[model samples]
Target: MRRVAVIGTGVIGASWAAHFLAHGLDVVASDPAPGAEARLRADVAAIWPTLAPIDGASPDRLTFTADAAEAVADADFVQENGPEREEVKDALFAVLDTAARPEVVLASSSSGLLPSVIARGCPEHPERVVIGHPFNPPHLIPLVEVVPGEKTAEKTVETAMAFYAGVGKRPIRLRQELPGHVANRLQAALWQEAYSLVERGVATVADIDTAITHGPGLRWAVLGPFLTQHLSGGPGGIAHVLEHLGPPTEAWWRDLGQVTLTRELVETLVAGVDEELAGIDRAELVAHRDAVLTALLAAKARTELP
Candidate 1:
């Protein structure tokens, strides 16, 4: 079994470690936080039952350390999930550069930082470092975007995709990097409208959420947006959508609310969310989200994809 090193033990980081471990891959996790060791142990144990179903129902395999270098010493792959700060990532990369095996592939769990920025820290492994970003709660959401930097080798991209696939993630190789990468760019597009609705007092946060979770979000759970659009067009396909609903959608796009981060707006948004979430405890919400996501993934696994 391949040994994977996880360099951070926070939410997204810990999820990666749990998925790796639960799939029966040997894992060595490291985090500088005071109680990160205990946190990771508890996290992996808790996430295993949900995560194990990805690879087949089985027991987990995980080990952790506070020593970053020790964790990557002999690892076949190193997944860096350190703080988003460049300096912190640079420092972590420096340690990983020394500890990891010569040919071991290294990937960042960064949401937006360019791989080129991360490459600055590990000169020797410049060809090996690439962005292996995942959707939130990665073990449940399987999309892994493999983004290669300007200096990144073609072989590096190939290797990274293979690695993610071997681990059962649905990896997509990005041709180039743009702001927010692919998935987040699509999400930002949607959020622009969500924000607009709230700003116009047309909908509350909860109402906007209800609109998606009950509407497109449910369908998206089974099919991608493009495919859904194609189906929505009926026999005429995309042409039919353009002939009918396209004009209205374009008008809505033109009228989208502007982006601003004023304090009042922030407060309003927060208060609205607080009111909307009054009955649901934060911990309980997380549990519900994970459960629903698990069930959705299991259901999707049974579909016949085209």
Candidate 2:
């Protein structure tokens, strides 16, 4: 079995550690925070059952240390989930670079930090550094963005991709790096429009959410926007859909409201959310969402959706 070193045993790190363990990979986790090991172990134990364990998986496969270098000393792969600060990351990677083997893939879980900037601290083997950004709560989310830096080696990217796939993640390779990567950019566009509509008195927060949840969101879960459009066009496919809807879509885009979040707007948005979620326990809502998401994922795995 492979060994994965998880530096920074916080939410993302703990999730990654649990995931590695679930796949029967021994995980050595490190974090400097007081009681970090306890918290990480507890979190992993809690999340372990939800993951469909295979390959002789068990939470007992995990070990922890306060020393980051010690964790990576004999690890097959190193996943850095330290604080999302460049200086902190640079300093941490410098320590990691000196400890880990030259060929071991050093991957980051950074949401937006560029891998090139991150590779600055590892002059010895900058080519081995790459981004393996997973969606939040890594174990539950299937998408892992395997992004490479300017100096990231092709071998490193290939290794990271294979490792993530081995752990049951759906890894997508980015041809070029971009701010917020791909999925976040798509979500940001939808969020901007949602915010604009609320600001322009077009819809309540609940109604806007309903519009997506009861409508396009269902289709989106099955396939991406382009493919959904193709299916919607029947025999015409995407080309026909574009020929028919392209002009009107462009018109809607031209009219989308641009919003700047002022203090008042922030308050309005918060209040809107509060009202929408009134009388609903946040924990229960999260539980329901996760339960449904898990079912959806299981169902998707049985298909050739893409």
Candidate 3:
């Protein structure tokens, strides 16, 4: 098994550590904060029972360190989740380049910043650096966007896809580098519509939640939106649905709002959320999210995969 180093210890980073370890890979995690090491170790331990039951798995090894170089010294792969600021990412990758093997692949859990930006200050920059952006709680969510920057090596992309697949992640090769990548971009599109609807008083916060949670989201759990639509229109496939629904879809696209996150809009959104989640505590919400995500992943594993 390869040794993997997770270069940040926040929730996303800790989740990566948990997944790598559960897959039987030795994971060495590093973060600069004084107590980050212990916190990471504890987070991984807490998530284990939930993870173990997913694939009947156990890690072959584990290690913790505060020094980035020490954490990545002999690692086969480095998964970074440091501060999203370009300068911080550049500095960290530069250090990682010096410590990791020349051929070792480096991946980022960044949701938006392009790989080119993160690779700028590193000696090994383009050849081995690529975005391995995963959905939140990567241990449970399987979609990993394997995005390649302009200078990223062809072989690097292939190796990353293969590597992620080995760990049981569903890796998608995005054709080009785009801010927010694919899934997030799609999500943001829906969010824009949802917000606009709320702002226009067409729906309440809870109504928007129900529309997705009970409607398209249910079928989407089994198949993606396009495929679901295709199935809905019968054997004529995607073409049939498009022929019928294309006009309205195009109209919606044309009318979509480019609303900025203005102060007033932000306040409205925040207030709505506060009202919606009035009685729920943050910790309880997180627990609820984890439980739902676990069940969703398990159901996906059984129903979506062959």
The TM-scores, one per candidate, come to 0.94, 0.96, 0.93
For candidate 1, the clash count comes to 0
201-282 per-residue lDDT for model 1 (tens digits): 9999999989999999988877789889989999999789988999999997788888676787788789889998998998
- lDDT string for model 2 (1-306, tens) is 289999998889998998899889999999999999899988887777678889688899899999999999999999999998999999999999999999999999998888999999998999999999998779898899989999999999999999999999999999999878888889889999999999989999899999999999999988989899999898989999899999999999999888888897888899998999998887678667768888989888888545
Q: Cα RMSDs of all predictions?
A: 1.9, 1.5, 2.0
Deviation of model 2 at 143, angstroms: 0.4
- The Cα RMSD in angstroms, rounded to one decimal, for candidate 3 relative to the true structure is 2.0
Q: What's model 3's TM-score?
A: 0.93
Candidate 1 lDDT at 36 equals: 93
Over 1-306, each residue of candidate 3 has an lDDT whose tens digit, in order, gives 478999998999998989988887878889999899788878888878667633444543667788999988899888999988898988899899888888888899999999888778577555899999998888888899999887789998999999999998999999988999999999998999888877777887778888998999888878898889889888888898899989998997898776677787777788888888988998798788889988887777777656
Would you give me the overall lDDT of model 3? 0.86
- The number of clashing residue pairs in each candidate reads 0, 0, 0
Residue 53 deviation, candidate 2, in Å? 0.6
Better of 1 and 3 by lDDT: 3
